[model samples]
Target chain A: MQDLLFYFFAVLTLIFGFLVVVNPFTRSPVTSAMFLVLSIISMSGLFVMLHAFFLAAIQILVYSGAVIVLFLFVIMLMDLKEEARSTFQGIRLTFSLLLAGLFATVLIGVVLTSGLGAEPVVLTLEGSTAVLGERLFNAYIIPFEILSVLLLVGMVGVVLLSKKNLN
Target chain B: MVGLEHYLVVSILLFSIGALGVMLRRNLLVIYMGLEMMLNAANLALVAFSRFNDNINGQILVFFIITVAAAEVAVGLALIVALYRRRRTTDVRELTDLKL
Candidate 1:
Protein backbone atom coordinates (compact mmCIF):
# COMPACT_ATOMS: atom_id res chain seq x y z
CA MET A 1 0.00 0.00 0.00
CA GLN A 2 2.72 2.43 0.97
CA ASP A 3 4.75 1.54 -2.08
CA LEU A 4 1.77 2.09 -4.32
CA LEU A 5 1.11 5.52 -2.87
CA PHE A 6 4.77 6.44 -3.07
CA TYR A 7 5.13 5.53 -6.74
CA PHE A 8 1.91 7.29 -7.65
CA PHE A 9 2.93 10.56 -6.05
CA ALA A 10 6.53 10.25 -7.17
CA VAL A 11 5.49 9.94 -10.79
CA LEU A 12 2.96 12.72 -10.44
CA THR A 13 5.55 14.96 -8.87
CA LEU A 14 8.11 14.39 -11.63
CA ILE A 15 5.62 14.95 -14.41
CA PHE A 16 4.30 18.14 -12.90
CA GLY A 17 7.80 19.28 -12.11
CA PHE A 18 8.83 18.67 -15.73
CA LEU A 19 5.82 20.62 -16.90
CA VAL A 20 6.82 23.39 -14.58
CA VAL A 21 10.33 23.46 -16.00
CA VAL A 22 10.48 22.89 -19.75
CA ASN A 23 7.05 22.24 -21.17
CA PRO A 24 7.50 22.43 -24.96
CA PHE A 25 4.91 25.02 -25.75
CA THR A 26 3.51 28.00 -23.85
CA ARG A 27 6.51 28.70 -21.71
CA SER A 28 4.39 31.14 -19.81
CA PRO A 29 5.36 31.57 -16.18
CA VAL A 30 1.71 31.36 -15.27
CA THR A 31 1.39 27.90 -16.73
CA SER A 32 4.52 26.75 -14.99
CA ALA A 33 3.27 28.23 -11.71
CA MET A 34 0.00 26.30 -12.03
CA PHE A 35 1.88 23.08 -12.65
CA LEU A 36 4.04 23.89 -9.68
CA VAL A 37 0.93 23.75 -7.53
CA LEU A 38 0.39 20.18 -8.59
CA SER A 39 4.00 19.28 -7.98
CA ILE A 40 3.96 20.74 -4.48
CA ILE A 41 0.74 18.90 -3.68
CA SER A 42 2.32 15.66 -4.80
CA MET A 43 5.37 16.30 -2.67
CA SER A 44 3.07 16.98 0.24
CA GLY A 45 1.43 13.65 -0.36
CA LEU A 46 4.84 12.00 -0.25
CA PHE A 47 5.36 13.68 3.09
CA VAL A 48 2.10 12.20 4.35
CA MET A 49 3.33 8.77 3.32
CA LEU A 50 6.41 9.45 5.38
CA HIS A 51 4.14 9.78 8.43
CA ALA A 52 5.07 13.38 9.03
CA PHE A 53 1.46 14.34 8.91
CA PHE A 54 1.98 17.81 10.31
CA LEU A 55 4.69 18.58 7.80
CA ALA A 56 2.48 17.33 5.02
CA ALA A 57 -0.32 19.63 6.09
CA ILE A 58 2.10 22.51 6.38
CA GLN A 59 3.50 21.69 2.95
CA ILE A 60 0.07 21.84 1.34
CA LEU A 61 -1.17 24.87 3.29
CA VAL A 62 2.00 26.89 2.99
CA TYR A 63 3.46 25.81 -0.36
CA SER A 64 0.48 25.03 -2.58
CA GLY A 65 -1.76 27.55 -0.89
CA ALA A 66 0.32 30.59 -0.01
CA VAL A 67 3.46 30.29 -2.15
CA ILE A 68 1.74 29.27 -5.37
CA VAL A 69 -0.80 32.05 -4.91
CA LEU A 70 2.08 34.47 -4.52
CA PHE A 71 3.62 33.12 -7.71
CA LEU A 72 0.35 33.63 -9.61
CA PHE A 73 -0.10 37.09 -8.16
CA VAL A 74 3.34 38.06 -9.35
CA ILE A 75 2.79 36.51 -12.77
CA MET A 76 -0.38 38.58 -13.11
CA LEU A 77 1.23 41.74 -11.80
CA MET A 78 4.08 41.64 -14.30
CA ASP A 79 3.39 42.29 -17.97
CA LEU A 80 4.67 38.96 -19.14
CA LYS A 81 5.07 38.86 -22.90
CA GLU A 82 4.51 35.13 -23.26
CA GLU A 83 8.11 34.96 -22.24
CA ALA A 84 10.30 32.32 -23.98
CA ARG A 85 7.45 30.80 -25.98
CA SER A 86 9.76 28.53 -27.98
CA THR A 87 11.75 25.50 -27.01
CA PHE A 88 15.52 25.42 -26.91
CA GLN A 89 17.35 24.69 -30.13
CA GLY A 90 20.86 23.98 -31.40
CA ILE A 91 24.04 23.53 -29.36
CA ARG A 92 22.81 25.32 -26.25
CA LEU A 93 19.88 22.95 -26.00
CA THR A 94 21.97 19.84 -26.38
CA PHE A 95 24.61 21.20 -24.08
CA SER A 96 22.20 22.05 -21.29
CA LEU A 97 20.40 18.73 -21.56
CA LEU A 98 23.71 16.93 -21.67
CA LEU A 99 24.84 18.72 -18.55
CA ALA A 100 21.62 17.84 -16.81
CA GLY A 101 21.99 14.24 -17.83
CA LEU A 102 25.53 14.12 -16.61
CA PHE A 103 24.47 15.60 -13.28
CA ALA A 104 21.69 13.04 -12.88
CA THR A 105 24.01 10.16 -13.71
CA VAL A 106 26.55 11.29 -11.15
CA LEU A 107 23.97 11.84 -8.46
CA ILE A 108 22.32 8.50 -9.07
CA GLY A 109 25.69 6.78 -8.92
CA VAL A 110 26.37 8.37 -5.56
CA VAL A 111 23.03 7.27 -4.21
CA LEU A 112 23.57 3.73 -5.47
CA THR A 113 26.87 3.48 -3.70
CA SER A 114 25.94 5.25 -0.43
CA GLY A 115 23.50 2.56 0.70
CA LEU A 116 22.17 5.06 3.21
CA GLY A 117 18.64 4.33 2.15
CA ALA A 118 18.95 0.54 2.12
CA GLU A 119 18.17 -0.08 5.78
CA PRO A 120 16.00 2.31 7.66
CA VAL A 121 16.83 2.68 11.32
CA VAL A 122 14.01 1.56 13.54
CA LEU A 123 13.15 4.35 15.96
CA THR A 124 10.04 5.84 17.48
CA LEU A 125 8.94 9.15 16.06
CA GLU A 126 5.35 9.83 16.92
CA GLY A 127 3.61 11.45 14.02
CA SER A 128 1.46 13.71 16.11
CA THR A 129 0.92 17.43 15.85
CA ALA A 130 0.93 17.68 19.62
CA VAL A 131 4.44 16.30 19.86
CA LEU A 132 5.62 18.61 17.09
CA GLY A 133 4.02 21.54 18.84
CA GLU A 134 5.68 20.67 22.09
CA ARG A 135 9.10 20.52 20.46
CA LEU A 136 8.50 23.76 18.56
CA PHE A 137 7.55 25.46 21.81
CA ASN A 138 10.39 23.96 23.78
CA ALA A 139 13.70 22.98 22.19
CA TYR A 140 13.23 24.76 18.87
CA ILE A 141 11.48 27.81 20.25
CA ILE A 142 14.25 30.31 19.53
CA PRO A 143 14.58 29.43 15.85
CA PHE A 144 10.84 29.54 15.42
CA GLU A 145 10.74 33.06 16.88
CA ILE A 146 13.61 34.03 14.63
CA LEU A 147 11.73 32.77 11.58
CA SER A 148 8.79 35.01 12.51
CA VAL A 149 11.14 37.97 12.56
CA LEU A 150 12.62 36.95 9.24
CA LEU A 151 9.16 36.84 7.75
CA LEU A 152 8.48 40.32 9.08
CA VAL A 153 11.63 41.60 7.46
CA GLY A 154 10.72 39.95 4.19
CA MET A 155 7.28 41.57 4.25
CA VAL A 156 8.83 44.98 4.80
CA GLY A 157 11.38 44.43 2.07
CA VAL A 158 8.78 43.37 -0.45
CA VAL A 159 6.59 46.37 0.27
CA LEU A 160 9.49 48.73 -0.07
CA LEU A 161 10.69 47.12 -3.27
CA SER A 162 7.32 47.11 -4.97
CA LYS A 163 6.26 50.62 -3.99
CA LYS A 164 6.14 53.03 -6.91
CA ASN A 165 7.80 56.42 -6.65
CA LEU A 166 8.60 56.16 -2.97
CA ASN A 167 9.69 59.61 -1.81
CA MET B 1 8.83 -1.38 -0.20
CA VAL B 2 9.58 2.12 -1.34
CA GLY B 3 12.68 3.22 0.46
CA LEU B 4 14.89 6.28 0.91
CA GLU B 5 16.70 5.47 -2.35
CA HIS B 6 13.49 6.02 -4.25
CA TYR B 7 12.98 9.41 -2.72
CA LEU B 8 16.59 10.45 -3.33
CA VAL B 9 16.39 9.37 -6.93
CA VAL B 10 13.27 11.42 -7.45
CA SER B 11 14.89 14.39 -5.76
CA ILE B 12 18.04 14.24 -7.87
CA LEU B 13 16.01 13.99 -11.03
CA LEU B 14 13.95 17.00 -10.02
CA PHE B 15 17.07 18.87 -9.10
CA SER B 16 18.65 18.18 -12.46
CA ILE B 17 15.60 19.38 -14.32
CA GLY B 18 15.64 22.54 -12.23
CA ALA B 19 19.27 23.07 -13.02
CA LEU B 20 18.48 22.67 -16.68
CA GLY B 21 15.79 25.28 -16.42
CA VAL B 22 18.12 27.67 -14.70
CA MET B 23 20.83 27.10 -17.25
CA LEU B 24 18.85 26.94 -20.49
CA ARG B 25 15.98 29.32 -19.93
CA ARG B 26 16.55 33.03 -20.40
CA ASN B 27 13.43 34.23 -18.65
CA LEU B 28 14.15 35.12 -15.04
CA LEU B 29 10.76 33.97 -13.78
CA VAL B 30 11.17 30.50 -15.24
CA ILE B 31 14.57 30.36 -13.65
CA TYR B 32 13.03 31.40 -10.36
CA MET B 33 10.45 28.68 -10.67
CA GLY B 34 13.28 26.26 -11.26
CA LEU B 35 14.93 27.50 -8.13
CA GLU B 36 11.77 26.76 -6.21
CA MET B 37 11.70 23.29 -7.69
CA MET B 38 15.24 22.69 -6.56
CA LEU B 39 14.39 23.81 -3.06
CA ASN B 40 11.42 21.47 -3.05
CA ALA B 41 13.61 18.59 -4.18
CA ALA B 42 15.85 19.25 -1.23
CA ASN B 43 12.87 19.40 1.09
CA LEU B 44 11.64 16.03 -0.15
CA ALA B 45 15.01 14.43 0.49
CA LEU B 46 15.09 15.91 3.98
CA VAL B 47 11.67 14.51 4.79
CA ALA B 48 12.62 11.11 3.43
CA PHE B 49 15.78 10.95 5.50
CA SER B 50 13.85 11.93 8.56
CA ARG B 51 11.35 9.22 7.89
CA PHE B 52 13.98 6.56 7.31
CA ASN B 53 15.93 7.52 10.39
CA ASP B 54 12.77 7.69 12.45
CA ASN B 55 13.80 11.05 13.79
CA ILE B 56 11.77 14.16 14.35
CA ASN B 57 14.67 16.54 13.77
CA GLY B 58 14.51 16.36 10.00
CA GLN B 59 10.83 17.20 9.98
CA ILE B 60 11.53 20.04 12.38
CA LEU B 61 14.14 21.35 9.99
CA VAL B 62 11.64 21.13 7.16
CA PHE B 63 9.31 23.41 9.11
CA PHE B 64 12.02 26.04 9.37
CA ILE B 65 12.89 25.58 5.71
CA ILE B 66 9.29 26.27 4.73
CA THR B 67 9.17 29.49 6.72
CA VAL B 68 12.44 30.68 5.25
CA ALA B 69 11.32 29.68 1.76
CA ALA B 70 8.18 31.77 2.14
CA ALA B 71 10.22 34.82 3.04
CA GLU B 72 12.53 34.12 0.15
CA VAL B 73 9.67 33.91 -2.33
CA ALA B 74 8.13 37.15 -1.10
CA VAL B 75 11.33 39.09 -1.49
CA GLY B 76 12.37 37.29 -4.68
CA LEU B 77 9.09 37.92 -6.47
CA ALA B 78 9.16 41.55 -5.42
CA LEU B 79 12.62 41.91 -6.87
CA ILE B 80 11.64 40.20 -10.10
CA VAL B 81 8.60 42.43 -10.46
CA ALA B 82 10.65 45.52 -9.83
CA LEU B 83 13.23 44.42 -12.38
CA TYR B 84 10.59 43.78 -14.99
CA ARG B 85 9.06 47.18 -14.39
CA ARG B 86 12.38 48.91 -14.82
CA ARG B 87 13.55 47.04 -17.90
CA ARG B 88 10.21 45.99 -19.42
CA THR B 89 11.70 42.52 -19.89
CA THR B 90 12.13 39.44 -17.73
CA ASP B 91 14.82 37.98 -19.95
CA VAL B 92 18.04 37.80 -17.99
CA ARG B 93 20.07 37.83 -21.18
CA GLU B 94 18.94 41.40 -21.85
CA LEU B 95 19.30 42.71 -18.31
CA THR B 96 23.05 43.09 -18.58
CA ASP B 97 23.39 46.70 -17.51
CA LEU B 98 25.97 45.82 -14.89
CA LYS B 99 28.26 44.26 -17.45
CA LEU B 100 31.87 45.20 -16.94
Candidate 2:
Protein backbone atom coordinates (compact mmCIF):
# COMPACT_ATOMS: atom_id res chain seq x y z
CA MET A 1 0.00 0.00 0.00
CA GLN A 2 2.71 2.47 0.96
CA ASP A 3 4.75 1.54 -2.06
CA LEU A 4 1.82 2.14 -4.37
CA LEU A 5 1.10 5.48 -2.79
CA PHE A 6 4.74 6.50 -3.10
CA TYR A 7 4.82 5.65 -6.79
CA PHE A 8 1.57 7.51 -7.39
CA PHE A 9 2.72 10.73 -5.79
CA ALA A 10 6.22 10.45 -7.19
CA VAL A 11 4.95 10.07 -10.75
CA LEU A 12 2.46 12.88 -10.28
CA THR A 13 5.21 15.14 -8.99
CA LEU A 14 7.51 14.41 -11.91
CA ILE A 15 4.75 14.76 -14.49
CA PHE A 16 3.43 18.07 -13.17
CA GLY A 17 6.95 19.34 -12.67
CA PHE A 18 7.72 18.53 -16.27
CA LEU A 19 4.61 20.33 -17.42
CA VAL A 20 5.69 23.38 -15.47
CA VAL A 21 8.94 23.44 -17.39
CA VAL A 22 7.97 22.32 -20.87
CA ASN A 23 4.26 22.11 -21.53
CA PRO A 24 3.75 21.23 -25.18
CA PHE A 25 0.14 22.40 -25.17
CA THR A 26 0.61 25.95 -23.91
CA ARG A 27 3.22 28.65 -23.51
CA SER A 28 1.32 30.63 -20.90
CA PRO A 29 3.10 31.36 -17.66
CA VAL A 30 -0.22 30.92 -15.89
CA THR A 31 -0.42 27.32 -17.02
CA SER A 32 3.09 26.73 -15.81
CA ALA A 33 2.22 28.32 -12.47
CA MET A 34 -0.82 26.10 -12.12
CA PHE A 35 1.22 23.05 -12.99
CA LEU A 36 3.76 24.10 -10.41
CA VAL A 37 1.03 24.09 -7.76
CA LEU A 38 0.12 20.53 -8.63
CA SER A 39 3.76 19.55 -8.54
CA ILE A 40 4.24 21.11 -5.11
CA ILE A 41 1.19 19.33 -3.68
CA SER A 42 2.47 16.00 -4.88
CA MET A 43 5.85 16.73 -3.33
CA SER A 44 4.12 17.34 -0.03
CA GLY A 45 2.63 13.90 -0.40
CA LEU A 46 6.14 12.53 -0.65
CA PHE A 47 7.07 14.50 2.49
CA VAL A 48 4.20 12.84 4.35
CA MET A 49 5.44 9.45 3.24
CA LEU A 50 8.80 10.29 4.75
CA HIS A 51 7.07 11.00 8.10
CA ALA A 52 7.86 14.70 8.05
CA PHE A 53 4.24 15.59 8.64
CA PHE A 54 4.93 19.15 9.80
CA LEU A 55 7.03 19.86 6.74
CA ALA A 56 4.28 18.46 4.55
CA ALA A 57 1.66 20.82 5.96
CA ILE A 58 4.05 23.75 5.83
CA GLN A 59 4.92 22.88 2.25
CA ILE A 60 1.25 22.95 1.23
CA LEU A 61 0.44 26.12 3.12
CA VAL A 62 3.48 28.13 2.20
CA TYR A 63 4.05 26.86 -1.33
CA SER A 64 0.69 26.05 -2.90
CA GLY A 65 -1.31 28.43 -0.76
CA ALA A 66 0.79 31.57 -0.65
CA VAL A 67 3.59 31.35 -3.22
CA ILE A 68 1.66 30.09 -6.22
CA VAL A 69 -1.07 32.65 -5.54
CA LEU A 70 1.57 35.34 -5.66
CA PHE A 71 2.68 34.03 -9.03
CA LEU A 72 -0.88 34.07 -10.34
CA PHE A 73 -1.45 37.59 -9.07
CA VAL A 74 1.66 38.80 -10.80
CA ILE A 75 0.72 36.98 -13.98
CA MET A 76 -2.74 38.53 -13.92
CA LEU A 77 -1.36 41.96 -13.12
CA MET A 78 1.11 41.73 -15.96
CA ASP A 79 -1.59 40.39 -18.32
CA LEU A 80 1.03 38.38 -20.13
CA LYS A 81 -0.01 36.70 -23.36
CA GLU A 82 1.07 33.27 -24.41
CA GLU A 83 4.70 33.40 -25.42
CA ALA A 84 5.53 32.78 -29.07
CA ARG A 85 6.64 29.20 -29.61
CA SER A 86 9.48 30.18 -31.90
CA THR A 87 11.44 31.93 -29.16
CA PHE A 88 13.58 28.86 -28.69
CA GLN A 89 16.77 29.13 -30.71
CA GLY A 90 17.75 25.68 -31.91
CA ILE A 91 21.44 25.81 -31.04
CA ARG A 92 20.86 27.38 -27.63
CA LEU A 93 18.16 24.85 -26.85
CA THR A 94 20.41 22.01 -27.79
CA PHE A 95 23.26 23.35 -25.68
CA SER A 96 21.01 23.89 -22.65
CA LEU A 97 19.66 20.35 -22.90
CA LEU A 98 23.12 18.94 -23.27
CA LEU A 99 24.44 20.82 -20.25
CA ALA A 100 21.46 19.83 -18.12
CA GLY A 101 21.86 16.23 -19.19
CA LEU A 102 25.50 16.29 -18.29
CA PHE A 103 24.72 17.71 -14.84
CA ALA A 104 22.09 15.07 -14.16
CA THR A 105 24.40 12.29 -15.34
CA VAL A 106 27.20 13.39 -13.02
CA LEU A 107 24.95 13.79 -9.99
CA ILE A 108 23.11 10.53 -10.50
CA GLY A 109 26.33 8.67 -11.08
CA VAL A 110 27.72 9.94 -7.78
CA VAL A 111 24.49 9.04 -5.96
CA LEU A 112 24.37 5.51 -7.34
CA THR A 113 28.01 4.80 -6.68
CA SER A 114 28.20 6.45 -3.25
CA GLY A 115 26.57 3.35 -1.73
CA LEU A 116 25.20 5.17 1.29
CA GLY A 117 22.98 2.22 2.13
CA ALA A 118 20.16 0.31 0.49
CA GLU A 119 18.28 -0.68 3.66
CA PRO A 120 16.14 1.91 5.33
CA VAL A 121 16.87 2.48 8.95
CA VAL A 122 14.00 2.60 11.39
CA LEU A 123 13.32 6.27 12.17
CA THR A 124 13.86 6.96 15.84
CA LEU A 125 12.54 10.49 15.64
CA GLU A 126 9.57 11.62 13.61
CA GLY A 127 9.47 15.24 12.44
CA SER A 128 6.31 16.21 14.25
CA THR A 129 5.45 19.89 14.75
CA ALA A 130 6.23 19.98 18.42
CA VAL A 131 9.69 18.55 18.03
CA LEU A 132 10.47 20.74 15.07
CA GLY A 133 9.28 23.80 16.96
CA GLU A 134 11.36 22.88 19.96
CA ARG A 135 14.44 22.49 17.84
CA LEU A 136 13.74 25.72 15.99
CA PHE A 137 13.31 27.71 19.18
CA ASN A 138 16.12 26.01 21.06
CA ALA A 139 19.08 24.97 19.01
CA TYR A 140 18.34 27.14 16.01
CA ILE A 141 17.07 30.23 17.73
CA ILE A 142 19.74 32.57 16.40
CA PRO A 143 19.23 31.54 12.80
CA PHE A 144 15.48 31.77 13.20
CA GLU A 145 15.78 35.31 14.48
CA ILE A 146 18.08 36.19 11.63
CA LEU A 147 15.67 34.70 9.12
CA SER A 148 12.93 36.98 10.40
CA VAL A 149 15.18 39.98 9.93
CA LEU A 150 16.01 38.81 6.41
CA LEU A 151 12.32 38.57 5.67
CA LEU A 152 11.78 42.09 6.92
CA VAL A 153 14.56 43.32 4.68
CA GLY A 154 13.09 41.44 1.76
CA MET A 155 9.69 43.03 2.38
CA VAL A 156 11.15 46.51 2.50
CA GLY A 157 13.24 45.91 -0.57
CA VAL A 158 10.26 44.63 -2.51
CA VAL A 159 8.20 47.66 -1.68
CA LEU A 160 11.00 49.96 -2.69
CA LEU A 161 11.60 48.12 -5.94
CA SER A 162 7.93 48.12 -6.89
CA LYS A 163 7.50 51.85 -6.32
CA LYS A 164 6.87 53.78 -9.54
CA ASN A 165 9.26 56.61 -8.69
CA LEU A 166 12.01 56.17 -6.18
CA ASN A 167 12.56 59.61 -4.78
CA MET B 1 9.94 -0.69 -1.10
CA VAL B 2 11.13 2.85 -1.74
CA GLY B 3 14.63 3.41 -0.44
CA LEU B 4 16.56 6.61 0.03
CA GLU B 5 18.09 6.21 -3.39
CA HIS B 6 14.64 6.23 -4.96
CA TYR B 7 13.83 9.53 -3.33
CA LEU B 8 17.25 10.90 -4.22
CA VAL B 9 16.80 9.90 -7.84
CA VAL B 10 13.48 11.70 -7.99
CA SER B 11 15.07 14.75 -6.47
CA ILE B 12 17.89 14.65 -8.99
CA LEU B 13 15.50 14.38 -11.93
CA LEU B 14 13.37 17.27 -10.67
CA PHE B 15 16.42 19.45 -10.20
CA SER B 16 17.63 18.61 -13.69
CA ILE B 17 14.26 19.51 -15.18
CA GLY B 18 14.27 22.77 -13.28
CA ALA B 19 17.74 23.57 -14.54
CA LEU B 20 16.63 22.85 -18.07
CA GLY B 21 13.66 25.17 -17.69
CA VAL B 22 15.81 27.98 -16.41
CA MET B 23 18.11 27.56 -19.37
CA LEU B 24 15.51 26.91 -22.07
CA ARG B 25 12.70 29.32 -21.21
CA ARG B 26 12.71 32.90 -22.41
CA ASN B 27 10.01 34.22 -20.11
CA LEU B 28 11.37 35.53 -16.82
CA LEU B 29 8.37 34.31 -14.85
CA VAL B 30 8.83 30.80 -16.16
CA ILE B 31 12.46 31.01 -15.20
CA TYR B 32 11.52 32.02 -11.68
CA MET B 33 9.18 29.05 -11.43
CA GLY B 34 12.08 26.87 -12.51
CA LEU B 35 14.14 28.25 -9.64
CA GLU B 36 11.33 27.33 -7.27
CA MET B 37 11.26 23.82 -8.69
CA MET B 38 14.95 23.48 -8.10
CA LEU B 39 14.60 24.59 -4.49
CA ASN B 40 11.79 22.11 -3.93
CA ALA B 41 13.97 19.37 -5.36
CA ALA B 42 16.65 20.15 -2.79
CA ASN B 43 14.01 20.19 -0.07
CA LEU B 44 12.82 16.73 -1.09
CA ALA B 45 16.32 15.36 -0.91
CA LEU B 46 16.86 16.86 2.53
CA VAL B 47 13.66 15.38 3.90
CA ALA B 48 14.55 11.98 2.50
CA PHE B 49 17.97 12.04 4.06
CA SER B 50 16.51 13.22 7.34
CA ARG B 51 14.15 10.27 7.41
CA PHE B 52 16.75 7.67 6.55
CA ASN B 53 19.34 9.06 8.91
CA ASP B 54 16.85 9.37 11.78
CA ASN B 55 17.76 13.00 12.30
CA ILE B 56 15.44 15.99 12.62
CA ASN B 57 18.13 18.47 11.65
CA GLY B 58 17.70 17.95 7.93
CA GLN B 59 13.99 18.69 8.25
CA ILE B 60 14.86 21.75 10.28
CA LEU B 61 17.10 22.90 7.47
CA VAL B 62 14.25 22.41 5.03
CA PHE B 63 12.09 24.64 7.19
CA PHE B 64 14.66 27.40 6.97
CA ILE B 65 14.96 26.78 3.24
CA ILE B 66 11.22 27.19 2.76
CA THR B 67 11.18 30.46 4.67
CA VAL B 68 14.07 31.76 2.64
CA ALA B 69 12.39 30.64 -0.56
CA ALA B 70 9.22 32.55 0.33
CA ALA B 71 11.18 35.75 0.81
CA GLU B 72 13.14 35.14 -2.36
CA VAL B 73 10.01 34.62 -4.46
CA ALA B 74 8.41 37.78 -3.12
CA VAL B 75 11.43 39.90 -3.85
CA GLY B 76 12.15 38.21 -7.16
CA LEU B 77 8.61 38.59 -8.51
CA ALA B 78 8.58 42.22 -7.52
CA LEU B 79 11.79 42.72 -9.45
CA ILE B 80 10.32 40.94 -12.44
CA VAL B 81 7.19 43.07 -12.27
CA ALA B 82 9.24 46.21 -11.98
CA LEU B 83 11.35 45.15 -14.92
CA TYR B 84 8.25 44.37 -16.94
CA ARG B 85 6.81 47.80 -16.22
CA ARG B 86 9.95 49.50 -17.45
CA ARG B 87 10.81 47.20 -20.33
CA ARG B 88 7.23 46.16 -21.23
CA THR B 89 8.29 42.61 -21.96
CA THR B 90 9.24 39.48 -20.02
CA ASP B 91 11.45 37.94 -22.67
CA VAL B 92 15.02 37.54 -21.39
CA ARG B 93 16.58 37.84 -24.81
CA GLU B 94 15.45 41.46 -25.07
CA LEU B 95 16.58 42.56 -21.59
CA THR B 96 20.19 42.79 -22.64
CA ASP B 97 20.91 46.39 -21.77
CA LEU B 98 23.70 45.25 -19.46
CA LYS B 99 25.46 43.20 -22.08
CA LEU B 100 28.94 44.48 -22.72
Alpha-carbon RMSD, each predicted model: 1.5, 1.2
Clash list (residue pairs), candidate 1: none
- Span of ten consecutive residues with least summed lDDT in model 2 chain A: A116-125
lDDT of 1 by residue, B6-84 (tens): 8899999989988988988887888988999999899889988887887888888988999899899999989988887
Q: True-contact fraction for model 2?
A: 0.85
Lowest-lDDT window of 10 residues in candidate 1 chain A?
A78-87
* lDDT (C-alpha) at residue A40 in model 2: 98
Positional deviation of A104 in candidate 1, in angstroms? 1.3
Model 1 residue A77 CA deviation (Å) reads: 1.2
**Candidate topping lDDT:** 2
Q: After superposition, how far is residue B80 of candidate 2 from its true place, in Å?
A: 0.8
